[model samples]
Target: MTEPTGLGMSKVARILMVEDDEDDYILTSDSLEQLDSYQFDIHWVTNPKVAVEKLSQEEFDICLLDFQLGAQSGLDVLRQAIKLGCMTPIIMLTGQDDDNLDKLAQDAGAVDYINKEDISTGRFARAIRYALARNEVASERLERLKAETQNRSKDRFLAHLSHELRTPLTSILGYTELLLQGEKAKESRSELNIILSNGKHLLSLLNDVLDLSKIAADKLELNPSEINLDSFIADVFYLLQINAQDKGLSLVITAPQALPERIRADSTRLRQILINLSYNAIKFTDHGQVAIKLWTEWVEQKELLFFEVADTGIGIPAERLASIFKPFEQVEDIVTRKEGGAGLGLAICTELARRMGGELSVESELGKGSRFRFAIEPGDISDVPRSELHFVKADTNQDNEHYDPLQGRVLVVDDAPDIRQLVQKICDGFGLQVVTAENGLQAVQMCNESLSLDTPFTLVLMDIHMPVLGGRQAIAQIREAGFTAPVIALTAAALKGVKRSLVDIGFSDVLHKPINKKALYQCMSMHLAAQESGEQIDEVEPHILLVEDDVDAAEVSKMLLESLGAKVTLAFTGAECLAVLQSSLPVCKILLDLHLPDTDGLSLAAQIRTISPELEIVVVSGAQIEASQLSALNISRSLLKPLNLSTLQSLID
Candidate 1:
C-alpha cells in the first residue's frame, strides 16, 4: 500500500516478532511474506524486555515469540506482556517439540504454540488466525463463568430464603389444619378449608421455585432405589385419580401384566414427573380422559423404559409446542392464563430427565390432545427377587375412614406446643390413648417408665430436631434402655434422602410437616392394628426359642411372651440357639434378635433354616433392615424394637 491505512479500515495485520536469533527472525519474516489472507506489517523486537515494552506501548493484531530468546525464554516475555495488560493474542514458536514447554507457554498467556521445524507460510497464517479465535473464545468463557457464578449465588440465596419462608408456612398450615378439624360450624369449616387450600397452593409454588433454582444451579441429585414399576405407576395413578374425577375426567394406567418388577430409579423424581404431567392434563382438560401407559423400548442397542401421560385436553397448537418446555413461556392466550401456573413444571421436568440421562418430549395436535413422555435406560435397574406382591389399599384419606377403634397408647414428642397438642387431639379423636412430651429427653424418660409400668408405648412419634436432646440421641438412649416401640421421625425438613437417613438412624418411618392427618393416621394405624389383633389370640400359644444377648432384654422379652400365654426357651447366643435346635425339644417359633454376641442375626437365621426349614423365624432387632431385604434373607417377619407386646403375640401365634 502506498499509504498507511487505519486499523478499522485496513486488510493488513500488524504483527510483532520477538526473537533473539537473526536466522529465526529471517525465517519468520519470509513465512509472513507468503501469507495469502492479508498483508503483514512486522515490528521486530530482539530483546525480551523490549518485546514486552513494545507490546504495551503500541497496538498489534498478534505477537509471535520464540521459546528461546538468548538467555531468557519466551514464556517469561509472554508473562511480562500479560502482566503489562497487553490484550493482543500471542503465539509461541519453539525450536524443538516439547509438550511441557507448550503448556508452560499457554499458562503464561500464550494463545497458541508452534514448532519451528513445522513452520510454513500457510501454517504460520493458520496459527495466527487460530490464536486470535482462541483468545476471543477464552474471553467469552471467562465472562460466561462470571455470569454463571453470580446466577448461582442468587439461586443459593433464594433457596435459603425460601426454606426460611417455609418454616413459618409449615406452622400456619399446621394450625389451619388443627382448626379445620375442631371447627364444628359449617361456615367456619368451609372458611378453614379455603385457608388450608390456599396455604397448600402457596407451598407448592414455593417448592416449584426452589426446585427450579436447584436445577439451574446444578445442585439437584438423583437418588436411585429399587421400585416395583407396576406398583409405583399404579400408586401415582391412584393419587391423581381423585383430581381427574373432580374435573369430570377419567384417569387410567395401561401397562403389561409383567414389567421389570424392580427397576432402580429415583422414585421421588419419577413420582414428581408423573404428578406434574397428570395434574396438568387434568387441569387443562374440561372433560374427557387422561391415560398413563408405561412400556419399554429398545433404541440404539439400549433398553429404555418409557412413561407417557396422554391427555384429551385443550392441546397446544403445532407452532407453540416448541416453546412449551421453555421456562415461563406458556402460550400467551386467555385459556393458558386461566390455567394459573408459572410455566416452570415442564422446564424443571425436562432438566430433571436430562440430568438423569433421559429426555422429556411432547407431541400435540391443536384442539385434539397432548402426550408428554420421558424415557430412561435401565442401566440402574436392580434385580429384585421374584415373589408374590402384597398391595396395601391406598391410604390417601384414612383419617376420614371409619377405622376400628385405635386400641393402643401412643407417645407424641415435639418441641412445638401447638404441634404436640394437634397430634394429641387427632390421636384422641381416633380412640387412641395419647401421652405427650415436649422434647426428646422427656420422651425417652416416658418410654423407660412405660416399659417399667407394664404399659409399654405402642408407637412413638419423635421429632428429629428438639431442645435438650435430638430424636437420634433419644432413640439411641431408648434402645439402650431396651425400649423399641416403633419410633417414627416427625420433622418439617422435607429433604432428599431424609427418610432413608432417618430409618438408618433408628426411625421406623418418617412423617414430614405440616403433617397430613391422613398420612399420620395411616402410619399409626398400621402399628396399632397389630396391637389390637394381639389382644385377641385365636391360635394356640407358640412354643418359642427366644435368642437375645442382652440380659435385661432377654428377661423383658420372656415376660412379654409369657404374658401372651406362650412357652419361652431363652437362648443367649447363636451357639445356644443351635444347641437348643439340636435337641428333641419342639421349638415352634424362633424370635431371633439380629445382633448376637457370637454371630449376626442373618447368618443365625440362615443356619436355623438349614436345621428346621418350616420353623417360623421372627427377626427382632434395633437394626434397620428393609422389608425387601428381610424377604430375601428368608426371614418370615422382622420387627423393630422396643417391642410392641401385641405385635409380638400376633407374630408368635
Candidate 2:
C-alpha cells in the first residue's frame, strides 16, 4: 500500500461506516485512520437507516458494515444501498463468529467480510481498498451486460418492423400499378397517389432503420473514394433544402474560399452524418435559420476539417444534453408527438463520427440555440487544383427515353375474347399483323391451311390452359410434328415449377401475365433479332410469341406487343398445334403457355428445346421461379405477374 502524501490526500478514498453501536463505529474509524499506507476518510453513522440515507446523498469510495446494529441489521442497510445503485465496495464486520449473519450480509450486497476481533488497522485498511476495487469491476460488468441486451432487443425490433412494412408496401405498389394502367377509376387516382407517397416514406424509414442497425453492429462498411468536398456538400444541401422548407426553416451553408478541391472519404457515410445533423436542426427549429459552417484546423500538426451545424431554436437543457446521444433518449417527452423519430439520429451520428477517427460535441443554452461540431483528418487532395472545380446542378425534370422495338408477326392465344381484342389493338398500334385463336385445335387448323397455301404462319402464341389441346401439349405436339420455332410461355401460374418446368418441357422463354407494352417490345426485340439472324427458327414465327390461358389477359398482352410493331398468331392448345404440325406445316416462332389443361408446360418446353436447341424459347408466367429450378431447366429470365413492359423488353431482347 502507498502512503498518503499531500497530493494523495487530496484524492484520498472516502469510506462510510454504518453501526448502531457508537463504540464499534469509533473503533472502525480509528483503525482505518491509523493505517500508515493509503489515505482514507471515514464517515460514521450510528443508525443503519441514516447510513443508507447518507449513501444516496453523496459519493463514497467504500462502505463498512456492523452486522448487529441494534434493532436494524446491517443486511437492511446493504439492501437499501444496493437498491439505490451505490456501487461502492462494502466490508461486513461481525462481533462474533456468526457465519450465518456474515453469509446474509455478503448475499445482501457486502463485497467482503471480516470478524470484529480480527480488525487490525492494517488488515482493515487493506480489506477496504480490496473491496472497493472489486466493486468497481462488478459494477462495470453489470453495465456492459445491460447494454448488450438492449442492443440485441433493438435489432430484433427493427428486423420485425421492416418485415411488417414490406408486406403492405408490396400490395400498395401492385394496386397502384393496376390503377396507373387505367384498370381503376380516375377518381381513385388521387387516393392511389397518396398511397404511393406514403409507401415511399415508409420505405425510406425502413432504409434508415437498416442503416442504423448496421452501424450499431459494426457492419456498416464505408467505401472511400476521391470526391470534391465542396460539390458533395452542395449536393447534400440541395437535397435537404426541401425538408428544411417544409418545416418553415431557413438553411444556410458557408464554406471557405479556398477549400480543398478533393478528399478521400466515404462520401455516403459523411453525407449521412451531415444529413442527420441538419435534419435534426431543421426539425427542432420552428423559426430562424439552420446554418452549416465548414472550416479547417491544425491538430497535432495534422490538417483536419471541421463541420458545425448551428440552429436558432429551442435549445436543450444542460443536464439533458449529455444524454441526447443515447439511443431512444430525446430532450422532450413529447418529441415523438411533435416531431416523429425513433430517437436514433444523434446516437447514430455520434457513432459515425467516432468511426471516422473523431468525435461529435455540442454546445447549447436553453431558450437560445445549439451548435454541434465534428472533426476529421483531411484526406490528401494536392493533386486536384482549384481551377478544376465546377458546379453541376441536378436536373429536376429529366425523363428516361422509352425503348421501342420493331414489331413483327405476333400471335395471341387464349380462351377469353376481351384479352384477345386488347392484345390485337396494342399490336395494331405498332403496325403488327395480329392473329388470334380460341383453342389449340383451331390454331393447328389455321397453320395447316396456311402451309397448304404455301404461306406458313409466322408465329404461334399458344395458351397454357384451354378447353382442348392446351398450350404445353400443343407446343410439344407442334415440335413432335417437325415444326421448329421459338416458343414464348405466357401464363398466370406463379408456382415455383411453372416457369422453369415450362422451359424444360419445350418453351423458349417465360413472361408473366398482365403484360406491359415496354416489356413486351423488349422481349420481342431480343429474341426476334436472334431468330432473324438466320438462326434455326422454330416452325412457328421466329420473332415473338405469347402464350396465356386467360382470354382477357392474353388479348391485352397481344395488344401491347403489337403496339411495338410485332405481328402475332394465337393458339389455344398443344394437341391442336400438334395436329397441324403432323400435317407438315412450317412455322417460325411459338409462344407456349405453361399451365395447359392437357400437360405440364415445363415438360413440353424441355421436349421442344431438345428438338430445337437453337430456337429461342421464353417462358411467360404469373409465378415466381426458384433459382434451383432455373438452374435445373437452364432458363435465365422470368417475369412476375402483371408484368411491366419495359422489364419484359429488357428480358427478351
Candidate 3:
C-alpha cells in the first residue's frame, strides 16, 4: 500500500508543502529556491485532508508540513499521509522547537522533524536519502529470518519422521532374526534372508533421509576416534561381498603395503559412507567388477586419507552427474526404477564428506563406468599394530569341550515370544538352562523368588521397551531389591548414545537386535561366568577369577578352567574385575585378560598386586608380551589364548 516511486517528473526536486499559513509556505519556497543545485517544484496543500489526497495522487521526493494548521496540527497530517499508505518521506516544519512535539511527529511516520527557522535544503535532502536506505535494509533482514524459520520447521518434521519409522523397523528386524536362527526348516532360510535384507535396506534409506535433513540444517556433528582403517574397510567389504557374488560381479580391495595403523575419524559415519557408495555401485552394476581402493596423499600441508569406489557396469550420462548429488534426484531410466531408491545416498555422502572437512566428486561416462572419490583430514597416528595384522580368525568350535561343569539358570525376558524362544533355544544348544518371562515385571518377580529360594539366576536378558514396566524401570526396581546379578539390555533402539544410556541405567551391557547368534552366545557366556556361586561347599574348590574383555576368548578360557575342576568367575573389563575384588569375593587365583577395554593387562596387574598382595595373578592375552616384560610387572606366569588346558591345569595344581 506504499507509494510506488517518484512521479512522471523531470530531474528536479518535487516537494509537497502542507501548510495553511501563507507566510510559512512562501518562506519554505524561498528557502528551497536558494539552493541552486536542483530545480524545486513545490505542491502546497492548505489542510490535512487535502494533504492526504495529494499524497495518494502524486509522488513527491519529500513532504514538509507546518506544526499548526487552521483546525488540525502537523501530527494530524503526518498520520493522515501514513494512513493513506504513501511511503513518501515527510519532514515536519515547526515554528517552535519543542522536544515532545518532535518525538510525536517522528513516531507518527514523519521521516524527520525540523523547525521552520532552521529548515534548509541540504538538511532535508540528507534525511530523505537516509530513510529510504534504512527501510530497504530492514525489509531484507526480515525476509531472511522468515526463510530460516521455515527451514528449521521442515528439519524438525524430518527428525520426527525418522523416529516413527525406526520404532516399527526394530520389530521387523528383530523377528526376522529370530525366525532365521530358530527355524530348522531349510526351505524357509532364503525367504527369511530376503525379509532381513529388505528391512535393513529400508533402515538405510530412512537413515539417509534423516542425515540429509541434519546436514541441510547444519546440525550434523562429528565424533572422531582412532580407527584401524585397513581392518575396518575389510569388514565393511566382506559384508557386501555376497551381494556381489550373487550378481556375478567381482569385488576387489586395493590398499598400500604399509598404510598407517590407525587414523582419527568418526569410524561409524566413515563406515556408513563407504557402505552406501559400495552398495549403490553394486546395485547398479551387472556382470562387472567393483573396486575399492585406499591411499593417503598430502594436500595443503595436511595428510588426506583418500577412498574411491568404482564399478564397471553402467555409467551416468554427462548431463545427469550434477543433479545426481541433489536430494531425491536420480537418472530417469528403467534401471533406476528397478533399483528402487529415493536417491538420497549420493547427496548424503556429499554432505557428510563436506562436514568431515573434505569433498566428494565423481567421474563417469555413459555405458563405461563410474568412480566416486572422497578424502578427509587425517589426524595423528598410533603405534599400535594394525587390526588386520593382529587379527586372528576365531575358531568357531572352540567351545566344543563337553565340560558343562558350571550349573546355573538364566532368565530370558522379552515381550516377543519368538525372541525369547530363540534365545532359549541357543542357550539350550550350549547346554545351559533358561527360564522365560513375558515382561520386565514378571522377570523381576522371578528374580526375587529365585534369590529367596537360594537359587539366584546367573544372567538376566531384559528387553528395553515393553508394554508393562519398561526395561530400565524394571532394572532399577531389581537393584533396589538387592539383586546383584549382571543384567544385559537387549534393545531394538540402536541409535547413538543408546549403549551409554543403557549402561547408565544400570545394565551390565547392551546388545542390538536382529541378533547375531555368535554374539548372543558370547554375551551370555561372559555374564554367566561373571561371579562365583554363593552356595556353600564341604571341600574348598579353587575359586579362580577370569578377567577378559573379548567374550570369545573369555568363553574359551572359562571352559578350560572349569574342565580343570576350578569354579570360574568372569569379568569383562579391568574396572569390573577390580569392583569384584573390592567386594571381598573369595579368590585363590586370577586369570586376568591383559587386553582389557578400559586398561592394559600389565597396568591392571600392578594395581591388583597393590590391593591384593597375597593373590596370584596370571596374564592372559591374544597379543604376545615377552617373559621379561611379565617379570617387570611382577607377574609369574603368562598364558596365550587358544589356551593350553594341560598347562593351565598343572599351574592350578
TM-score for each prediction? 0.44, 0.38, 0.51
Compare the candidates by lDDT and give the number of the best one.
1
Estimate, for each residue in 1-653, the C-alpha lDDT of model 3 and write its tens digit.
Answer: 12323654223657788888898888778877765444667888897888888988887767877888876787877787788787777888888889999899989998788877675656755664465445445555656667866875875576456545655665677657655645463588778778878898888877777677667656666889887665676677767888899999999987764567778889868888889889888988886799988877888877788899999868898878888898888643523577677778888888888878689999998788889999977685435343333332232212333434335688889887767877776677677778999898998899889887767788788887776888877887787687888788887554455665466446778886656566777776666665564532222344688898766577787898788777877788998777656542467889887677799888888889887887888877777779888877677788776677887887688
On a 0 to 1 TM-score scale, where does candidate 1 land against the true structure? 0.44
Ranking by TM-score: 3, 1, 2
Worst 10 residues of 2 by lDDT: 393-402
Give model 2 RMSD, 1 decimal: 22.7
Model 1 per-residue lDDT tens digits across residues 1-653: 11235454325667899988888889888887775455778888898889989988887878998998888878888888899899888999998888898888888888788999767756767887676556557667667778867885886577456646665666778777666545354567757766776787788777778788767655566878777765776677666777888888988777653457678778878777778888888888887899888777777876777889999888988878878888887643524678678888888888878766689999987778899999875564435443333333354312345656676788999887877887887788778889999899999889999997766788899877778998877876787687756778887655455565455445667887767777788888776665556642122233588999876689898999888878887888998888667643457889899999899999988889898888888898787788886787677888889987888868765
lDDT of residue 232 for candidate 2: 85
Clashes of 1: 3
Rank the models by lDDT, top first.
1, 3, 2
Q: How much RMSD separates candidate 1 from the native structure?
A: 18.9
Clashing pairs in 1: 483-642, 484-641, 484-642
